[model samples]
Target: MKKKSAVLLVLSVLVIGILSYIGAFGLNVGDYRVKSFSQMLSKGLDLQGGVSVVEEIQGKADNTAIEKTIDLINLRINKLGVSETAVSKEGNNKIRIDVPGKFDKDEVINLIGKTGKLTFKDPNGGIILTGDDVKDASASISQETQKPIINLELKPAGTKKFAAATQKFLGQKITIYMDDQKITDPTVDVAITNGQAIIEGSASLEEAKNRADIIKSGALPVKLKVVQSQIVGASLGADALPKSIFAAEIAIGLIFIFMLLVYRIPGLMANIALVLFIVLVLFIFVTIKATLTLSGIAGLILTIGMAVDANVLIFERFKEELKLGKPVRSAFEAGFHRAMSSIVDSNVTTIITGCVLYALGIGQVKGFALTLVIGVITSMFTAIIVSKHLISWAINIGLINKASHFGVNLRGDNNA
Candidate 1:
């Protein structure tokens, strides 16, 4: 039964793999050969020809921070109901954003382009400050009233500035600005000594909740100017997917073969993990309706390589376990456990990179970064969970004998 379950799992993964390659578009296996590579998948802005918008990020440049801004921009594009949008940042203070053509180009622009504006005001109501000076924002409640509010903390300089503003505007409005646009206007009743402030103007339950979250997530530190914007046409996706997939396939193939040759049995499991990793990642992308921009495709390919690297780590550890003459199951388990540390450390580091790219990178690079992050996460799952399940299954099926566990050989390779 255990072997059967594992076989079923492998079969299920195989079906998913075939489907992903074919995509959601109606597939006639007979007609599959006749279809152009373009028909197999969607295109991004660069390929389809859509609008690209470049903007200036406006302050404090950490490569990491800038990358995160880029990721956020891509998220906005995703919300606009388009897939394959490109969003990234330029130099120290600018963002480059793009997406494919749409009938409502203006709407897409508005959706992807706005800076998050969140505000708060004093009860007496006179202007104080906005999200611009906030060093951080988070969800909390007023100490006195215990009502939900977004806590806003200003930068050191911003703190002094906000304190002064609150002192002067006591009994007045302190509106939050997102891209110089007002979000919430909370009232300030007294001078605030702490850098902390609260935003109290959510119009609805959901709105308030969202405002609280935005505050917690922290708003864009500075104002951004949209330097450029354009809607790309549909033709781009057709052109891009083929090239992207071709690159990804070649890379994955090379990695698979390399693993098999270098590590033997363990390498085979890693390769299987890699394929499952790809399937899960793409499945998430399509389900999430992520816009598949050119940079996004590039990110996906990059993740493919990383996923294989994760497998390699595990397989290498398996070698250590085998050399110790541990039983097959014990060796497999030990190797997986040992490899887990490397896999996690590497993936976490990459995730941080992705987060930065998402934050400040903007446009297509942002897309790539977001996809890369997602792919990394999904890779971890397939590598740790899916791969283990497969190996355990093989052992259960009597695929490996007592001698086979240590100096073994098998017919065909799982990854191949």
Candidate 2:
């Protein structure tokens, strides 16, 4: 590489590192948020603070029933326009729900815990059908009115019942009730004998979709009773963020000092690559919008340590090559080549374990797994690609050329 190009490359890497840091932490320009990492990262309930509820099945329920209940709850929560909601099985007959962000505690509890129990009733208040009879429901637009509407399909038994009811109640109204609260009552103009029905008068498509989702969730296989409910305070997790950031800063500072003091020039190269690695990993997290939990911070710290270890291995190998009478450039190549296998093996294994954990684990464990996987991938790229180029550029430009500069001892005078 030419001297000018090499110089520009090094400066560019450093500038990118600084900008990445600013972006991850954030910067403000006047009244505008310039580079806000907090906005980009999705905080979990522990970090942002929200309501948590634990509900137990009211009657006989097995694992399958519990899972179905959880699924239904998930649907209801999602329909409420909340993201980053967590619904997980607690034990044999219990499920836990966590919702992030501030909300009305009572309203949220009522919304989630309500059995929904949508029922169709005649004008005389006689039951016609229940939500369980419906097979599927979705939202769409009405071709005639150009307004949002809900489409519902019934199961075979529901179809027969609804057909008979519509035939009997023609020119009359059939009321739809959710938890005994009247939702919509439309006149049966004709007999809907094809197992399909359309609900009109929705204000918007989103409202239509929400109604459909609520109706579908109302068909959950089991009833749930709230056993525990609380609004978690963010003070604990909020305080943890700064402390963890401080610790991470100290860790990086100490690692940089140790590397620079021990390996001299190569250590400086590794430190630069480490900065790039940190930036890349954080950027990836933001891109993927992975929730950053405390366990995720732990995984990040571990990955940083492992990244430094990769550099140590390569630098040691480089020193050995130098001691064997190899020149600076040759020793750099030989070091990276020799260290490649070990780095690949270790990182590959770590990634595999992370994938396994992510697949089988839940909640915080999955958070740890996600960060671990991203960290390992970025660490390898930093070690092999970023470090290699920077170190080779330094030697090529004569910025580092002496054996002493590499922390290698001179043996017999055979250095070429």
For candidate 2, write residues 215-284 as lDDT tens digits: 6766668887889988988896889888987899999999999999999987888898898888788788
**Residue 19 CA displacement from its true place in model 1, Å:** 4.4
**What lDDT score belongs to each candidate, Candidate 1 first?**
0.66, 0.83
Whose lDDT is greatest here? 2
TM-score of each: 0.54, 0.75
Best by TM-score: 2
Global Cα RMSD, each model:
10.8, 5.0
Q: Report, for all candidates in order, the number of backbone clashes.
A: 76, 0
Cα lDDT for residue 397, candidate 1: 64
